[model samples]
Target: MTLQNDLQSALGFLNQGKFKQALKQSKGGMKRHKSHPDFPNIAGISLSGLGKHRDAIPYFKKALALAPGFHDARKNLAQTLLFLQQGEPAMKLLERVLKDQPGDQAALYLQAQAHLVMNAPEAAIVTATAALARDPRQPRMLRLRATAWNTLGDEKAALADYQAAVKVNPNDADALQNASLLLARLMRQDEATETARKAVAVAPQNVEARRRLASQLISNGDSAAARGQCLALMELDPKDTQVLEMLARISSRDQNAELLPVAQKALKAAAPRSLDRANVSFALARIADQAGDKEAFAAHNDEANACMAAQTPYDYEGSERQFSRIMAAFPDVITPAETAPEGPRPIYVVGMPRSGTTLTETVIGLHPDVFPLGERGVPAFLLHPCLDKDQDFTPEAARDFTADDISRLPEMPKGTRAYVDKMPDNYRLLGHLGTAYPDAQFVHLCRDPRDVALSIWRGYFSGSSLTYAYDLKAMAHRFNLYGRLMQHWRQVMPGRIYDLRYETFVADIEGESRKLADFCGLTWVEDMAHPERHEGQVLTLSNTQVRQTAHTRSIGKWEKYADVLAPFIDGLNPEIWPEIKG
Candidate 1:
């Protein structure tokens, strides 16, 4: 074939995604035309298409060497560098391309991506916005800007851009998935689930889309559908440990004995002390627990916790120091604000994880006048930044959490007397929140430390913030800190805080729920006692549990595992629980 014919043939193959054929043709052309820039450029493009980014670099450089002003080769080289996460070098090359061709949308989009990879979301927003200005219908640019907006914590703006991107391309699974997450974050669970379904519908073969849909389904209490999604995911990647773990969770919840052997198989195949092992171990623990095999449950739970502790060791001393600082910062009684902030009053449900906070919030939300905002980070997000260098709460910090900051929270429905913020860790921020919202009521859920510790140990928490949950000693230390802080809050803010014992609340659901509703200044209703009847999403680890009727089954759950949790029980501070024999 002629030189031109060879180049055209290679280009055609590359355009059709026949990367191997393109590479062969391009190599043949390069043998005949040793100094041709197009041949090397085509070869580089083909190599990149074949996911050989490293190998493509030399060819792109050779093309650039033969033709110094080769914008296409330079752009291609920048993209390959980005694929390798070499953001700085990729950025410089893109800058050169944009300098030569200022209106190149392709280069602009890549520039935005490079900015994101380098952790410069603000720069990415600017670059992506400029590209979108040229064509508002560009879904890629819209999605890129939405990601930047999300990185900057502007969920509303992020949602808007994502929706715009979806409007431009209804089949854009990425935009749909992201929009669903933001929607869920904004307390719109139904919309989030629908959006996730749309994403799965459009990208049936996409594992991530399917996984997200399964998560939404699980959160929405559709376990059957979630299991179907998990089955599909298993078909997609039979060895995916995450899929196995997810299936195990669903199977445990449904008491599907068929998956017990599958989970065991995954556990055996997983690497020792690895996250995959840890996840599968947790799953196996759940299955064992469901099957009423105490020995197997203990063995699997111990292995899971051990693996997790190895991966993420807790800083007990650092946490103790932080607790000390928090206590010292609020040494004196904080008088509640005289005038309540002009918005929906907030009922803060604060406690340790698995301490009945979600149950309390669900019960409160059953009241017609209350809306549940599950585990919002707004209080900490607003207050932590205002803390003094010593990490002390300041009057200035209270003033800093102004009307504007309150606006960041989800809006309550009309006639709502108060909104529930059931973020358990917000207990640490009560000193600031109590001083900011005059009408705020604090419902502190107190569970038996043994039961709390057991529950926490049995479950897998996602973030580094909960590293303490993986070890017995760390759990005891954290419980002590929580106890100390709660005592301080009780002394400093007397009437504003309501201590609700989880056992007491569950035993007398109606009677205690009345007091809780009254404490929040909401008129007591019979519905408040039946949280299970409330048809709203529960998006916590205890989501499934909260959907069931209140039960005392978990009240003294630690008794069953007392022998296994001896260290944890012994480490508990007796002073915090005088009723228990340590």
Candidate 2:
């Protein structure tokens, strides 16, 4: 065959994704037409397509050597270098290409990717924005810019760009998946679930999309659907430890015996000291607990916690100092603002994780006049500049909140008297909340330290914020810090904060719920006592638990593992839990 015919055949094979065939055709063309840059460039493209990125580098270099001004070969080499994580060298080559062809969108997109690889998210945003300006319908550029925004912690901007990308290209499963995650994080459960469903429909075989859909289904209290998704995932990869863990989480007592053996197999296959191993161990612990085998439960629970602790060690002293600063910052009572911000009243439910915060919110949400906004980070996000820095927070920071800050809060439904913000970590931000909103009411949930610690240890937390939860000693220290901080708030804001003990609340649901309702200015209704009947979505770890009728089964649950929790029990400060005796 002639040189042109061979090159055309190779190009056609490359376009058809037949990488080996393309490589063979291009190799034959190179032998016939020696020193042809196009032949070497096409060979490099085929090699890169076949995942031989290292081997592709030398061919691109040869093409560039034969024709020094071959921009396509230079761009191809730059991309291969990026795949190899050599961002600096790749960046230099892209700059040269852009210098030669200033309006090349392909080079610009790759340059943005190189910026991301270099950890320069701001620079990536600039490059992506320029490309997007020229072509607003470019979904790739939109998604790239969205990623840069997410890296800079601007979730709203990231979400907007992601949604825009999906609008431009409806079948983009990756953009749909990312948008769904942002929606879930923003406490929009129904929307998140819907978006996840679209993603799964667009890419039926995508494991991550299926997993995301299952997680959203679980959050929305659809356990049966989540189990079905897990089963599908198992069919895709029978040995997937994550799928096994999800099955274990949503399994019923009757299903525990059936799932236990599968979870054990996954544990044996998991890597030592890895997150997957930790998750499998947690699953085994759950199975054992359901089967009423306390010894096995303790063994697996301890193993899971040990693996997590090795991965993320807590900074106890640093946390102690932070808590101390928070306490010192609010030495005196924060009087309500002279003019309360006019809008729906906010009921702040604050406590440690697994302290019945979700349960309390569920009961309150049963009132027709209340809207449940689950676990919003708006308060923390707005106050982060003041509180999360090296400097100590001052009373002046509270007064600095403006109309724009209040406008950023989630909108309330029509005719709603109040909304609940049930983020448990808001215990640390009571002073800011109280000073900013005159109509805001704080309800503090308190549970036994031992129960809370054990629950946290067994739970799978996703972020660095809860690193203290994996270790018994760190949990105890954090419990003490929380106790002291709550005491400070009580002393400073007398009559402003309501303390609701989980045990007490569960014992007399109607009577205690009546007081809670009255405190929040809601009329007494029978539905308030039956939170299980509430139709709103729950997006917390207690999603499934809160759907069941209120019970005291969880109270004093740590007693069953008393022998295993001896170290944790000894670490607790007596001052914090005067109820516990030696």
TM-score of each: 0.90, 0.87
Looking at model 1, report the run of 10 residues with the lowest lDDT sum: 385-394
Candidate 2: the clashing residue pairs are none
Cα lDDT tens digits, model 1, 1-582, are 898798889999998999999999999999999988999999999999989999999999999999999999999999999999999999999999999899999999999999999999999999988888888999989998998887776677899999999999999999999999888878889899999999999999988889888888888888889989999998998877787777777775455477777777887788999999998888888788888888988999999999999999999778877777777877899876677777688889999999999999999988887889888865665565444347444556566675646656665688877889999999998888888887888999988888999899888887777998999988888888888789899999988899999999999999999988888888899998898886777777887998899999998888888887788878778887667754
TM-score of 1: 0.90
Report, for every candidate in turn, its global Cα lDDT versus the true structure. 0.86, 0.86
C-alpha positional error of residue 337 in candidate 2 after TM-score superposition, expressed in Å = 4.7
lDDT of 2: 0.86
**Structure candidate 1, residue pairs in collision:** none
Tens digits of per-residue lDDT for model 2, 536-560: 5677789898989999998888887
TM-score of 2: 0.87
lDDT score, candidate 1: 0.86
Best by TM-score: 1
* Clash count for each candidate, listed in order shown: 0, 0
